[model samples]
Target: MADGERLASVTWLFGQPERDSVTEQAASPSQPTTADAPRGRHEPPTRAERASRAGEFQRINNVSMHALARRGMSVAEMRDYLIGREFDQHEADEECDRLLGVGLLDDFALAETLIRTLRQRKGLGRSGVTAELRRRRLENDAIEAALEDLDDDELARAIDLAERRAPQLRSLDTETATRRLSGFLMRKGYSSGVVRAAVDRALSRSGESSGPVFR
Candidate 1:
């Protein structure tokens, strides 16, 4: 793809910039204004209206921050959440910037924590974790950085996952066990090679004999 196309694809994930809602026009005191002048006749927002808008934004920000306090959220996730709650996109973006500035939202940190939790607690492989991160709309750099840590331990992790799930399949025949366990590992995002190896190891440990069942 061309550079422009690539950039477009990435930007498509976040949508377009929102238009500003409030527009202000200033008039010179010495200038003569006509009553029929569209520009002169229009009144700018009042101080109370501005304050009310500011308070609304603040309330939205506070609610979002409280949600973040309970658990980490990716910047895109928070922005989308605010937008879904009827906050203007520009205002939502401002709130996201403020939170990010204060370190309340860190995509890299969120990616790392999510990667660890998915792998250790949920037994998700690199592909599974990557898909999850993308679903959360994390930046590509953050996702790559988090996935870097999985390079050395993927096979071992796959084996461990298979081993843990091996017992339930022990009652099945060798072919059935191999098929079931291989499918399970594949669904967890293990590559065919890793799935085959893990299934072989798992079935062997369970005293079942099966040749390579995956290519």
Candidate 2:
């Protein structure tokens, strides 16, 4: 038999003898002893079992948090991931809060970093950045901060980006070149005025159509 069954059998066997004595002891409360001790500490979960439970929770938390960090999780994304897997919402919230409180997650900081990366590397525009930040569930404050900083010299950056890619559109006719440049600027989130100015400049430099190519 298993240890638990064996122990239970042994307990059952000795239980009859102890029953009368326990009743007598209970009837007389003049001198209490271990036999008269309340059925606490020895009942329910033992210390080892409690310790094991705590250890399991700790391990689960560590592995999950590390996996999330490795996967580049935002707070809401992490919450959604956990919820999609059937984790209790309250528990997920608690764990997410703990992670955020301990600096394991910072959505605002992440949004700023992403904004810089996309703008500098991908040549994305303000609208694109805002959409990306929204996808990450970042607060408006972070989005606003990123946008505010971008306004300082966005025109210069956009001009530089256009210059680098202008060669690609150069092969096309003047109408095509103007159309391409305007479309590019529009897709990059530039204002209509900015896109028009850039496209005019590009067409002029290309010795192409000076008339507006975009209707």
Candidate 3:
């Protein structure tokens, strides 16, 4: 009887704990654990898979080449173009550097070419050429450099334009003709002084007076 009583005690204490341990071991994988928990909400992105830079560079280069094929672009223009296409800024910058090195993107050269076109084809004055270069995103230094080689016949060009336009003003009085000619030259990007001189010279040529007498 004592042995059975002792056996009952042992079953109540040790046996219960042993069965609990085995149940825990069997149930462990099914239950959630610290290691099995989902990733934190604030995990850093460095561990995430990233696209290859080389691949990105090649794609950007392709896009840049296609854009350049259509028209010559300044460095800033190409940069804006790449950014508009959703390329990364740093990557776009590197590609621009590459293009500049290869002579594909040249702001100064572009400025020079545009200056000639603006002068010869469009009949723009120095101010007009400078404004156009600015619109094209050429640097200030580049604009200055391009303007340095500009043709020295600005006054002549302005006079030519004014003379051509003066005949239309023959019906108007001297004051009216002078005012109209001055306005036209100013809009063409000539300075106030240049406009005055051009108006006088042009009016003289159109027989408005014997010659410009500083008026």
Top of the candidates by TM-score: 1
- Expressed as tens digits, the lDDT of each residue in 4-113 for candidate 1 is 99999878765533212122123434445576456435678879979998998779878887889888999999998888988889988989999999999999999999
Give the least accurate 10-residue stretch of model 3, judged by summed lDDT: 206-215
- The residue ranges of model 3 lying beyond 4 angstroms of the native Cα positions read 1-55, 208-215
State each model's C-alpha RMSD to the native.
Answer: 23.7, 12.6, 6.7
What lDDT does model 3 reach?
Answer: 0.84
TM-score of 2: 0.68
- Please give the distance, in angstroms, between residue 197's alpha carbon in candidate 1 and its true position after superposition: 0.7
The segments of candidate 1 whose C-alpha lies over 4 angstroms from its true place after superposition are 1-54, 208-215
Question: Please, what are the lDDT tens digits per residue for candidate 2 over residues 82-127?
Answer: 7776677886787788888997777777777887888888887677
Per-prediction TM-score: 0.71, 0.68, 0.68
Model 2 clash pairs? none
lDDT of 3 at 116: 78
Candidate 3 lDDT by residue in tens digits, 86-133: 988998899999999999999988998898788788778899888889
Worst 10 residues of 1 by lDDT: 17-26
Sort by TM-score, top down from the best: 1, 2, 3
